[model samples]
Target: MREPLLRIEGLRTVFRIPGGEFAAVDGVDLEVPRGRTLGVVGESGCGKSVLSLSVMRLVPPPGRVAAGHVWLEGRDLLALPMEQMRQVRGSRVAMIFQEPMTSLNPVHSVGAQIVEAMRAHDPGASAAALKERAIEALRRVRIPAPERRFEEYPHQLSGGMRQRVMIAMALACSPRLLIADEPTTALDVTVQAQILDLLRELQAETGMSIILITHDLGVVAEMADEVAVMYAGRVVERAAARALFEDPQHPYTLGLLGSVPRLDEERERLLAIEGVVPPPFALPKGCRFHPRCPFAIEACRMAPPALEEIAPGHLAACIRAPVEQSVAA
Candidate 1:
């Protein structure tokens, strides 16, 4: 088997609450194979975004990576010094944040921003060369009139255009790993398709691995090679995309897939997973998801279940995994 481009082991990111700290991302173990996309899917507050930020080491103040290793190409990122980590961020691993409006500076022109990103890694390069390279980056993402778009500020462009610019900047440094958090939020369906296609084309060209974090299971179905379903700060199920969609083992994964509006299936109403994700500080004592799991029994409330494999490369945390077999018996 080919070695994974990125490997995460027991990652935990904690935030300070009033009296103590709570782990927003708890004990996540994931691997993104070289040139393959790994989709992290879950509803709001499930710590999908925090997991991505933890990998980037960009968790805001009062939130820190309390434990675990983020191994990128065999190097432990969490162990790196601040300065070394800064150097690794843009040139080695880049992120496209959820909101381009806030992520992109309102003051700087898009071209200058891309140029700055490049200059960080290639400071000795002449200004003219960097500007040319930035414009080329815009063109690479299929932005029309690359020169004019380059000079425009973030607000001047349409939402789709801004997203393209974000993608362009992310790819500018030719990083090996790209973590995109909700790259298509608030865009129309047409534009969403375009951005996803652009990412696919770029991945094909560069052979770079992607960690795509989003709540849209539809997007994951179309883009991801593997899927990890998260709930209440932990991954509940992990499997290849087809295996997951065809035979989800965890109740939460079933709930998520059932909730998506399917064109072929007829239903009076969309299925919704009952109850909100529990607050990290006030998580349930046994299984974190037992409160909402329809299959919960007395045994489920006894202790947290381990993520165990029922079949090759398919893992679930629920005790009654291989749920169909368990249900049939």
Candidate 2:
């Protein structure tokens, strides 16, 4: 088997809450093969974003990685010293945050920020070279008049354009792994499609692995080679994108799929998963999703089901996955 480009095992991150600590990311495991995209999908407040942040070692203050290893090309990122980790971040692994306005600096020109990122990785490179590379990055992301845009500030560009700039900066270093957290958030439908297409084109050219963190099933269907379905900080199901879409095992996974509007199947009402995601500090024992599971049994409320392989390359944290299918039929 080919070694994965990125591997995460038993990863846990915690936040110091007002009352106590909450495990924002709880014992999650994931991997990404080189040149493939892995979609991390879950509802809001389900720790999808935190998992990505943990991988990059950028979980905000009051939250820190509590356990597990983030392996990048056989090297353990968690064990690396601060200086080494810093070097590895923009150089080997880059992340595009959810919001561009918050991520991009208001004070600095887009060109200057990209140049700064490049310089961090390659300080020996001359200013002229960095500027040229910055323009090239913008052009690669399909920003028209790269030189003109390079001089523009973050506030000057449209939302989609700012997102492209974020992508430009993330790819400027040519990192092997790209973690995009809701990269197309808040964009109009047309802009969202354009951004997704741009990402696909760039991935094809660079062969860079991507871990897309989003709740949009449509986006996952369009981009992910594999999908990991997360709920309440745990990966409830994982499989190839096609397999997961065709045969979702976990109740939450099924509910999420049911929520998407189908083109062929006509329906009066879109399905919705009952109950909001439980607060991190108020998570229930046993299966976190038991309350919302339509087919929940006594066993579901007894104890947390371990994630087990139900088929080759497919795993789900449910004991009655087969039964659920039978019941649905």
Candidate 3:
């Protein structure tokens, strides 16, 4: 059997708030195979973005990965020195942030940023060579007249164009893994599809593995081979995308699937998962999602359940997975 491209074991990322510390991401374990994409889906603040940042060691101050091992191709990334990790980041792994505008430096032209990224990993590359590669990267992402766009600042481009530039920079290094956190957050539906198609095309060409973090289930269904549904800092359910979506196990997962407006079924209002995700500082004693889970019982409030394999290659954290429902809708 081949080894996983990226594997996370007992990953726990925490943050310090006003009163005390909060475990933004707690005990997450996942594996991404080579040339595959893992879609992490969850409501906002459920630690989806935090998980990606933790993997990259880019969690901003007041927040850090407090525990666990991040293994990439048999090496423990968590144990690597800061300088070594820096070298590993762009050359072996890269990320496309949630918002391109905020992620990009407004002061520098788009071309300059791409060139700088290339130079960081391949410092031997001359300025002329790097610039040519930068322009070629832009062309690769299907940007019109790449030479002109290279000289423009992020603010000058439309949202879609800016996103394309972000993708270009991330792929310029040809890293083995790409962690994209909400890469289509603000784009229109059509543009969203285009960006997704572009990513698929690039992945097909390079055989790169991707960790696509997004709240959009539609995106998950379209892009992911495997999906991990997160709730309150932990993955509540994980399975092949079709299995998880069509035969959801956990209540949270069911609620998420129900909330999506399916064209096959017409409904006046979408079913929503009741209650908001509680702040990590005030997380519930047992299962963090028990408060919002309609089927939660006394046992559920007493102790959190470990993620157990309910079926081959399928896991769910809820003790009462594949919840028993009575007849008659």
lDDT (CA) per prediction: 0.92, 0.93, 0.91
RMSD of 3: 1.8
Residue by residue across 1-329, what tens digits does model 2's lDDT show?
79999999999999998878999889999999999999999988889999988888989999999999999998999999999999899889999977899999999999999999999899899999999999999999999999999999999999999999999999988899999999997799899999999999999999999999999999999999999999999999999999999878888898999999988899999889898899999998899999898888888889999999999999999877866464776
Sorting all predicted structures by TM-score, with the top scorer first, yields: 1, 2, 3
TM-score, predicted candidate 3 vs. hidden true structure: 0.96
Q: Residues 1-329, candidate 3: write the lDDT tens digits.
A: 57889999999999998888989899999999899999999988899999998888889999999999999988898899999999889878999976799989999999999999999999999999999999999999999999999999999999899999999999998899999999998889999999999999999999999999999998999999999999889988889998887788988888888889987899999989898889888889888888888878888898989999988989999887767741121
- What TM-score goes with each of the models? 0.98, 0.97, 0.96
* Residue 16 in model 3: lDDT: 91
Question: Which sections of candidate 1 miss by over 4 Å?
Answer: none
Better of 1 and 3 by TM-score: 1
Pick by TM-score: 2 or 3, better one: 2
Q: Give the TM-score (vs. native) of candidate 2.
A: 0.97
Q: Cα deviation of 60 in candidate 2 (Å)?
A: 1.3
Worst 10 residues of 2 by lDDT: 320-329
Error of 3 at 299 (Å): 0.4
lDDT of 2 at 286: 90
